[model samples]
Target: MSRVRQILDMNAFDAATGGDGAVKRRLDNLGAASVLFYREPIEMVAARGAWMEARDGTRYLDFYNNVPSVGHSHPEVVAAISAQVARLNTNTRYLVEIVDDYLEALKAKLPVDLSNVVMTCSGSEANDLAIRVARAVSGRHGLIVTDTAYHGNTALVTEASPSALRRSPLPDHVVTVPAPGEAAYGGEDIAGGLRAAVVAAMQTLEARGHGIAAFLADSIFSSDGIFADPAGFLQPAVKTVQAAGGLYIADEVQPGFGRTGDAFWGYERHGLAPDIVTMGKPMGNGFPMAGMAARPEHLAMFCEDVGYFNTFGGNPVAAAAGRAVLRVIAAEGLQENARRVGAHLKAGLAQIAAGSDRVTAVRGAGLFLGVDLGAQDGSGAPDADYTVQVIDRMRDARVLIGAAGQFGATLKVRPPLCLSMAEAERFLEAFAGAVSD
Candidate 1:
């Protein structure tokens, strides 16, 4: 087996083909970077709502994807994309009403101070540009993020992403702080810990002659094992950055578009307004669309120094798709649905944990929940091996899920916002069976 395949559990690989011939053929053409899930990747044919259909006619309830936030192939979103593509699709240089409409609607959801929008093709591009804007505005190059954060895949961002730095060293201009979980729980002062971390990082950066430029964080801390609780815990960190003459950049790619259910944006839940917010994933409901929202004053510096223009960003087709998503969210009341269904799902998972010895901590807000799998010996250590086994078992039970956290021992349960109560029940039942068996 190749190195990547070796990293994945061989026992979990789907042996439906009874051989590695198919895998070998695909690997020969696509190369090693083609990362796939499971010991045996599912041959998916189609998806709708919260269910994905496999080539073998198996239907798996999807609790792993947030990209299709509204739902897979939603009729309205599809119609909008089809109509716009057929009618016209052009770059942002041309005058377009749809783009203007989307920008206005999106800005309306944000704070009035964030009046500027710069569209990009992906979350990576959005973060990359946001970094540039922060550097120009603050006139500094130092950046800080969570210890295990995964911001994006661009060269500049990949260096800033500590998770991506597993194989490589982080750039000198970047600093990392412990995630909120380490200090939030365990009877520690969450805000104080966060403030100290930022202060330490700023001191180091200043000593090296690179004053703090920005303190970037994924609102949900999705990569740092989903540390979201004790709402308003992030206020101290944000304030610390501002006091140090740095921008607070909120990475909303994972927790934006009402995924948290309590608020339209995750930062809103903490009641802390960010200087710059980057969004993607659910923006176009699976379409390649992303952008950053910023306060006019902060963006003014960047605009004056070096204006940006993307070729395909904010195009007519993307705008139409974005608009349709906004409409569907309101029409279907998916945000409230997430609140209700997420609560029900979390409660059910809690019930399951109450009876099991392996399941430990259950945390998250709205539709973004994480369940921790711990050692059976009562050591409180992450049991990543057990997590892998549970994932394989859930696949057998036709429930699609995945893992996260520094050790990959936490079950990452983020379904489409449109997930129904009945689907939630079905997943709970399947999960119970997977764990009990």
Candidate 2:
């Protein structure tokens, strides 16, 4: 079996080997914390719509950044941010109309029962808050996550994110189940198998005296290689957890904001009404903002013990940016666009996979798709090295992409929601050439 790969290590630029003066300067500044893409990182200057311009003036079609879900430098978002900042930019303590307006607009898209929304600076903070609320509401310390899940980078979230851990074993309060897919659960009954795994994980947690507080998962399983098929596969497991007195936290940082096409949120695709829904980055269209939605009672319970406050979580500027993102997504009909263009893109990739042994599996919904690359020797083993080569080749072809999954062989295809059919075809063409070469 291939050794499981760490999330940040996948296709990361190694500063040790060295680079140009700019790269050296960056390493000197950020040191070991610097996470650059590609062995030869591109210095980007500007980006608009689906394409980014390097400092050298080369344009690359972006297919890996979900943070710019609506698009890169969307005029409305930029305008809104500028306009709001020019007028006023204050924290949540001030009763900013834009903040409330944005919250109302956001809540309109969420479950009605999740009445209270607490804004945060990032998904890490949102997830951290969700975990605390879950523990408070359920009175349990244990958490369950997928084997290769990556919730966020905060110490609390990092403890639960197995993919983020390079050396440390999962703490006793955390337990993991295999990702919901054929490779983990077999083809017979994925939903049932996953439910059983969660049940067993809950049992283990209970045995450890840390009864399950939450079953936190990225609804589409993005880092677990983008598993979106068997549509309601998560229902059984989520129900089992809830029945066992555990909250279900839908980490929508990756799959929220109509990226999944069929629904506004990925949890909706699985017919789930999550107890806690955490969203980030894409909510503000690259603006630094994130939020957690929960039942008022649950949030109140958590707050009673310790108050929650963020300096600039739902500030006026962030609210304006978020409002603009929501407006743009609705006005431009990006969700439908995602559904249509994503289907076309997926079909093109599936066609390529059908004809090529190296392209193993294609999965996911909407613009968020994952294509596994395998060895060419007919062994069908996941080839991380070949995946890196394909990524580099795609870069050479002026297309930006990245890798995911436990083996780091799954091409994570998540272009902006505003991706056009022409752009999709361009990516397909680049990808075909890259894999073939």
Candidate 3:
């Protein structure tokens, strides 16, 4: 199926929107490429911390959106953005204290060596810049990404994203490596598997005359079904890439900003220091702000050869928003909250899986959890159709969730970091009911 068609078909969309008018208008304007969530889509007008209020006044516990890391429409983030925008909004051509301050604060949270940053407007831009820099610095054109990984949505990045290329063949310069799934490993070394995959991919790329430029992967493997276990398993892969003269770029757009609870960045969980790190989505809460951090020495070659600059990147307003998100994360101790509430949520999911024959496995760390939905016949095979039903059912119960994995059979339950214990319980209750249904 096409990437856009994999989400919702026309009949389903028509039924969800209650008529053909909204669908027709969208198809007329946005064309057939627009993707929306849920069988019965909710028209959300407003949202707050961990909850979204629809146009009809229905409230839903949001467990899908990580963009609002701190919370939806957070007062502090709003105030910061408002204060900065009202005062001044301009390019990064001139010196700005807030921009430098934000960069310093972000650096403090990252690895000590990743001191240099190049800000962008989105994760796609960040990844694009990272890839460009890696290729320029390494003087190679080959890239390696996970089989079902999704980095972002740009011309260059789309080729790197296997999830977006579902039915299509990847480009010549790109190599797809298998993502490590728990079920795939039978007492095998996880790190070894990752290293082997990278080695094989690099060999293929070299044979194709596209020497390895970079091995880019989301540290959490979000689109490859959220494989975050066996901490430090990615260290071997990082070493393999670096030893082969390829840069290891950590796409932390999904796993950054303390969502993992254990560490600030997902790569930190695996005890691996990436050559370059890209962050977005939750960086400035809802604001459009993202950036790529790298070792100054590694990025210096690219800067000297093909000097880079962005117009709206790291502006005062975005800096203010980013600073607010960092402040809120530290002040509210949301990382601790994710650790506690994520554990509670995972335990509750385990309890539900214990009761249901259809639930095959529960995986992931912190606020990012994936529930494997199995066939109804007790065969334990991935059941994408059944997973879709459960997602729609959860939506009916006013809980927002999503699916991931190659077959889209894993329930992607990554709620906001601020999810409370009560909210986690509520989600568990709803999820248990959905599984039974």
Candidate 4:
């Protein structure tokens, strides 16, 4: 650990949100980092449904983070996990019907060709495994990812991520292309922009004398301003990569499980089939369960060689959680809920943006929306002071929101799939009040 971390530990945040305001001399003496540099702080003690309680007993509506796809501490999901733990909780070596059922149900949500499953502990691990599968199946060594994108913090995925990350470096076999958004050459032709980026990736592979193992993308570009461009653009790119004997790996860590509303997987919107789809974050509704789906042939390669294994992946306990989440998602009709609520939220943001110079634009689909805070002030001169002020104001009004994209100007609103229309209305009302203030 760094000296800064050491200092933080020594100077433990004593108060709930450092409520006591007691600062340790050791921490005061050390250097600063993200934890120490937070501007809007919330001392959360508990959370349920769409609301979270702060240390001071204040209630904050959560309009950010899809990681808990279902509501927090959902009774059904919790019960499923508890029931499984009370029974059997073993590994892959065991003959387990639960594991098989979980994988099977999971397959039902993925592209038909990406049918086989490999469970992991997190999205980063799933992405890592997906890359490994691509490399092994294609006999290629190069990987391509979007610029300004974020896959995970794993060494390889981190390097493949965009420079927005703090400090990530990949090995020689990795290449990058800008995500199709305002920053890249897409100009609204996001799929075409991705295709162009794929061309550059192909060139990169040739230069390395290695075929591309995979072309990995977050279907709608969630980490890069939620860029879900015209649907069919990715097909040509996938074709090109397949021609080069590569696989398309969709990192569905964020937008999977009906986040996009129209489909279970965001890649579906692109009108292309991915050979591999890696999922995590919301799989177990916060239970640290993740997995990847690949065509059976690619899976055979791994089974043939070393034999894939994970101590905790798909353990009976994890399987139960996964099963419950899958059941709830379908039974509750959360996909349709996402569509209705997402549309309402986005429309509200667009309406609020009109006649207001503080917003550059609003874009996204389903339960995932991004509000581009214009740099221009009320007089049309550049001034992000409005955006900054709005975030602080929203926090004060007991709502949680986050920032995204390359410039950090867009306010991200990715609520749980179960968030109701009434909650959407509350969020919009708060946002409007913040803007007006």
What is the Å distance of residue 307 in model 3 from its true position?
Answer: 1.7
Best by TM-score: 2
Taking the tens digit of each residue's C-alpha lDDT, what string does model 2 give over 229-326?
A: 88999999999999989999999999999998999999999999899999997999999999999999999999999989999999999999999999
- Candidate 1 per-residue C-alpha lDDT over 388-436 given as tens digits, one digit per residue, 9 for 90 to 100: 8888888888888888777778888999999988899988988888778
Q: Model 4, stretches more than 4 Å misplaced?
A: 1-40, 167-171, 186-188, 377-386
lDDT to native, each model: 0.86, 0.94, 0.87, 0.77
Q: Where is the poorest 10-residue window by lDDT in model 1?
A: 1-10
Error of 2 at 202 (Å): 0.5
- Whichever of 2 and 4 has more lDDT, that candidate is 2
Ranking by TM-score: 2, 3, 1, 4
Worst 10 residues of 4 by lDDT: 1-10
**lDDT: which is higher, 3 or 4?**
3
lDDT of 1: 0.86
